[model samples]
Target: MKNVITISRQYGSGGREIGKKLADKLGIPFYDNELINLAAKESGFCASVFENAENKATNSLLYSIAMGMNAYGNQELGFTNLSLDDRIYLAQSDVIRKVAQKGPCVIVGRCADYVLKDTPGVINVFIWADIDFRIKRVMESDNLTEAKVIERIQKIDKGRANYYNYHSSEKWGRAENYHLSLRSDFIGIDSCADCIKSYIEYANNK
Candidate 1:
């Protein structure tokens, strides 16, 4: 069976770029926003719903609690109730698994590393960069002011961490959670992809 490569990345850490480049180098499909589109199509849901839930977790614990309550005489009030984020994530997770079944691919974010954990020959990688490097990348890419860049970077990274940690039972961006943790700051994106390719080759041979 072809191997699967799942990449979990920090915000503004060039993870998506690295994944894309790696997929190109390896001649495989690159799944990032493509997952959102596929999920929306497969689930018959609006794309915006999946987009919104992309790296965010539900903050509505009260909603879940209320749904769990059966005190009301109204059955409809507590029946088949799941938070919108949960539904979207469930749908996306299903899609991720299906896509992985097709063959080798470079999957970016969306808890894909965890989603495919049980699959043999799956390689999980986490990409990170220094705070200053990430901030500069955010600023240059988004054309945001330094302050806004910092704020957005922090908020997005927190969302990613919370989403991954809540769903995966593992720490996001921690070295132990991944087979490889590469610093985009130390090596350029293409070089990073080359390194990952070599690692994949070696693992396949072993």
Candidate 2:
């Protein structure tokens, strides 16, 4: 069986970098924003549509309407008539599933854990860091001021939380939602990657 890893992370927590490195070490494909392009291609939507819908949840009323339409009506009339946000989400969800079916890989964000919840040999991880640590990291990496970094982090994390919560039954960044949760600030990015690698190895062995 192939082992797939899904990483949910706080903004500026180095989750993407760690996932890439881990995938490299494990000799597997790493997917992040690349999923957006793939979804765009697969769904025949423009890349900008996917980008706008990325990590964002649709409004509750629209989501309910979309679900009801999907459930009670023909997909061509129902799904095609839905909002762009819902369409993009559905497209991305399909893309995520198709990618997982191909084999083992490291998928960062996009609620991949929720997407593969029932799939065997799937390991979910969540990465977080203290505000201070995240702010410093974002500022350094993006060359932004502390205040701007904080704002950016808050906006992105909020979007992520909303997206995850809207799509799945589990709460975002909660330990119960994932198989493993690590504080990158506490152990450092490289060490966090190492820990995830060890966990994957152990999980595969079992």
Candidate 3:
């Protein structure tokens, strides 16, 4: 209950659902899109700017040393000197760290694991499912055809991978980078949430 749970998930995986369920079960705050609003308030950037930054194409400019808080702090020093995209990212990272420091919360996506990499009492989780499972989930949610769902999933997944890799020192979805990894296809979404809760209990108790 004292740990911040950061979830990095593949597209169409029910990772957000699981994080919300887990946070509800734990009586904790859940942050996904909410981080953008928080950052907008704190940094004076519009919420849409942060959302749009994720879709921006970046070559190699935004990537830095990826040393959690310190790396972000030292990145080009003057906040005004950074590009709009980098500024939005760092602003969101600032909000992420602030919320994590405040108390235990369930944060989904946005490379939260890497942002809080150096923080203690933080559990990083990766959620993934098989292609078929993901496609079906997306189809149901987006009301898209199978082929369209597949395309959507691939595009979203690629964007997520790029964003995480560009910002974090570690590779996306790599097992070692996270404290726990779950297969949502094999384990039901609710079960995945429960399993994580169990893991946190056992790990913290030890």
Q: Which stretch of 10 consecutive residues in model 2 shows the poorest summed lDDT?
A: 66-75
* RMSD (Å) per prediction: 4.5, 2.8, 3.5
Candidate 3 stretches greater than 4 Å from native: 55-76
lDDT values for all models = 0.80, 0.83, 0.83
Give me the runs in candidate 2 sitting further than 4 Å from their true place. 56-81
| TM, every model | 0.88, 0.89, 0.89
Residue 115 displacement (Å), model 2: 0.9
TM-score of 2: 0.89
Per-residue accuracy of model 1 over 32-68 as CA lDDT, tens digit each: 8989999999979999878857444433344335333
Report the error of model 3 at residue 76, Å: 6.0
Q: Which stretches of candidate 1 lie over 4 Å from their true place?
A: 58-79
Candidate 2 per-residue lDDT over residues 1-206, each given as its tens digit: 54799999999998998899899989999998899999999999999877856444435455455544343233457575556666777889899899999999999998899989999888999999889999998898889999899878877887778777766757898899888999999989999989999998887787
Ranking by TM-score: 3, 2, 1
lDDT score at residue 173, model 2, on the 0-100 scale: 88
